[model samples]
Target: MSKPIIATTSLAGCFGCHMAILDIDARILQLIDLVEFNKSPIDDIKTFTKECDIGIIEGGCCNSENIHVLKEFRKHCKILISLGECAIMGGLPALRNGIPVKECLEEAYLNGPTVGRNTERILPNDEELPMILDKVYPCHEIVKIDYYLPGCPPKADLIWAAVVALVTGDELNIPYELVKFD
Candidate 1:
């Protein structure tokens, strides 16, 4: 039998979740033996080359592009897993949920001290840029997420164990300490 295909993506996040996947150390070799990676930063695959058995999403959707990519994952993968707190509940980015979008844009573009010399007070309106959402939305809110692994960055042990179990049809050993929110 062939190994499963796994794809991963990080949307409105710090990439901490993806880093945790790599923190599995030597177990990563086992992962390589058990699955083929597709459309993941792990291999820098920019597009989905083929259908995948598993899709691991690491962050919430904060823009149009995130939604597009996430929907594409839902279309291409047999199973979709939300891999961290951000993907499950929007996390830190959701702090701006109640704040007005205009305020946030002003703070970043016009009023920010780092961006001095704003002679024209230009706010980014490029067609090439993905439009920011009024508020960050969790992955499940945007699409049908089949599973959630909740953590600020989910411990490497938890990720390794979960993926191994999913691939091999074994039971999960998710201890209380492994499913942290912070």
Candidate 2:
């Protein structure tokens, strides 16, 4: 029998989640031997192919690229795991939900004291930048999320539990160390 294919992808996030996965260290080595890593930065992956056994997506939908990735992940992975607080509830970036997108962009780029202040030159309607969603939402809102493990970057043990469950087809006993945050 062939080993299950496991793929990991990132969206609008700091990539801290990806780094955290590596924090699993030696356990990941075991995982590498057990499953094929179809998509992950560590493997120089850039896209998702069809029919992945387990897909781990870290980050939230914040742009067109993110949306495209999410939809593709939904279409491809049999079991999708939302890896962190960002994918579960849009983290720090979602804090801007109450503010206008234009104002937020200004605070980031235009209105900064160090940046040039030229409203006439400022273009809020850039074609490349996706319009911000009216409110932050978890992955399930856009597409069905089979499982979720929440944390700023979820406790590594939780990630390991989820991976084991997916690979072994068993219910994971949520360890106290893993669910303490909830």
lDDT of 2 by residue, 86-173 (tens): 8888877788778877777778777677767676756567687776666656677799999888876777777787788789889889
TM-score of each: 0.97, 0.88
For candidate 1, what is the TM-score?
0.97
- The most accurate candidate by TM-score is 1
Tell me, by lDDT, which candidate is best.
1
Error of 2 at 6 (Å): 1.4
Q: Kindly report which residue pairs in candidate 2 clash with one another.
A: none
lDDT of 1 by residue, 17-72 (tens): 99999999888888899999999999999999999999999999999999999999
